[model samples]
Target: MLYWFFTNPVSLSRWADKHAEGRKLFFKCLYLFTAFLGIAVAASGAVESALAWMPRSWVRYDEDGESEWIASSIAHVAGFIVAFFVTLKGAELATRIRRLEEESN
Candidate 1:
């Protein structure tokens, strides 16, 4: 997963060429997607932890009633994470489409 975060598609292909002997296309695609997922998870976890450590002014909890601050913060992080990964994956897919088109031409 870290490999994906650190390398672009071309680098990944080269790494596979060097290390993934006899690997099927299915596994390579799986690895790429899973690495993306790992990135998303790491980002989301960081957001959650950052929120948890934010100043009182940034994240205030209700003292008298059922505190919804934690849930709110979590929801915020979750939404950001979903949006981030969706956008990232969409870009990656679009790049793949363009690359395939170029190859076919």
Candidate 2:
């Protein structure tokens, strides 16, 4: 299934060369993003569990709920950042490929 996506010879060749040139930068960014996501999810889950385990005394007004809210907000922000960068990179790569194709025409 994934193989089919990259099997077009022309696209494959172009993509391979482009990827090779950008591989280090791409993987560095990818791994950093992945790590951020992992940390954010884990932190959010931990916050939720902590809130659940809290004593009745800690369940007062919304002020007491701020920590969980902060954790969840961080997770959401990290997700948005990763998605934004991924989309931006994909669009840039697509544009470069299209331009190359047009030039070769």
Q: Candidate 1, clashing residue pairs?
A: none
Model 1 over residues 1-105: C-alpha lDDT tens digits? 656624555455556667777874654576557656666676667666667655445545576754455644674668567756665785577468657866999
Report the Cα lDDT for residue 38, model 1. 62
Note the Cα lDDT for every prediction shown.
0.62, 0.53
User: Can you give the lDDT of residue 95 in candidate 2?
Assistant: 56
Query: Cα RMSD for candidate 1?
Result: 6.5
Best by lDDT: 1
> How many pairs of residues in model 1 come into backbone collision?
0
lDDT by residue (tens digit), candidate 2, 1-105: 345323333444455466667574554455445545555566556555655544444432365554344444544565566556654665466558868887999
Q: What is the lDDT of residue 13 in candidate 2?
A: 42
What's the CA error at residue 22 for candidate 1, in Å? 8.5
- The reply for model 1, stretches above 4 Å from the true place, is 1-6, 14-24, 53-105
